[model samples]
Target: MNMRNLIVFSLLSLFMGLFLVLAFSLAGSGGVPQSMGVNNSFGEIKIKRMVAPDFSLDLYDDREIRLSELRGNVVVLDFWSSWCSPCRKEAAVLAEVYLEYRDKGVVFLGISIWDRDEDALAHIEEFDVQYPSGPDSKGEILVEYGVTGIPEKVFIDQRGNKVRKFTGPSTKDELVAILDDMLGSGY
Candidate 1:
């Protein structure tokens, strides 16, 4: 074979080898399966309700909020980060939906994980989010919620039980359906 053809083949072989190594490394580290589990459920609910673990957060507004205090109100816990593209995509939908349900016995709370406070607060402002938001600085909240990635959501019923978890970006309709169900509405 010509020297030019030989060189091309060698380069391609090296690139393929490197790609395989990277892929295998990620898979071996359990990253592949974890990422693959970021389920987007739309409005479907299939999980049985479990009592939500309580948590306290210092909101961006310098106020403290405890999950237990929100009893008797439906809660939506949005787990997101500014660096996550899917989170950014759903920010507007969350903000708009929160407004619609704010006075309907629904409470929307944002938990920013794996992001700087500045970035998280900036994203909140950029999205014009009126809901209370706070940073999960130590990731305790994330661990408790079994969140493996950003853009996950946990819905709580009026009795403070975790009703469902949506693992990726959600739409306005999806949020509405869940909220309606939690509120005992016929929607």
Candidate 2:
């Protein structure tokens, strides 16, 4: 083959070999680990891309959710508090967006910070929240995500990279558009 063709073929083979190695490494480990690779300049890639902080929390409904387990889909991590007025105001909007994107492989998770389970559940029921929500009983998730106040919205792309963080309240249109931009663009 010509020199140009030989170079292209060699690069393709090298990439395929890398892919095989990555796949086997993941399978042998049972699940994806945190902080896969770091370049120290361009940031790191974990679980095939940028790493989102992983955690397992018990939901109000007795179900459990681990952020790392929700790979291969867009993960929305919103830090909210039931006592925050802005959070109360955006409750309906959040529920609407959550229901709208429920079927499109988008996972919306609400982490109620600085709130008691009793109050959070009451607020959740008052808003008729359909998606499962849980209280950050230990505040570890809040510290990990660097949440400062209620109504903080974080968007994680399909590869687990935190793509956007919206502090304070957001309108329904604003959130829906973001979801569309991220999910529709196939990222």
lDDT of each: 0.83, 0.78
User: Lowest lDDT 10-mer window, candidate 2?
Assistant: 37-46
Per-residue alpha-carbon lDDT of model 1 for 1-187, expressed as tens digits? 9999999999999999999977876675333323333345443345677899999999999999999999989899998877677888999999999999999999999998877777788999999999999988898999998887768888888888887888778888878877777788432
TM-score of model 1 relative to the true fold? Answer: 0.75
Q: Among all windows of ten consecutive residues in candidate 1, which has the lowest summed lDDT?
A: 29-38
- Where does model 2 exceed 4 Å of error? 1-49
Model 2 lDDT tens row, 95-178? 999999989989989888766678789999999888878988888998887665556778899888887777667788888888
Overall local distance difference test of candidate 1? 0.83
Total clashes in model 1, counting residue pairs 3 or more apart in sequence or in different chains? 0
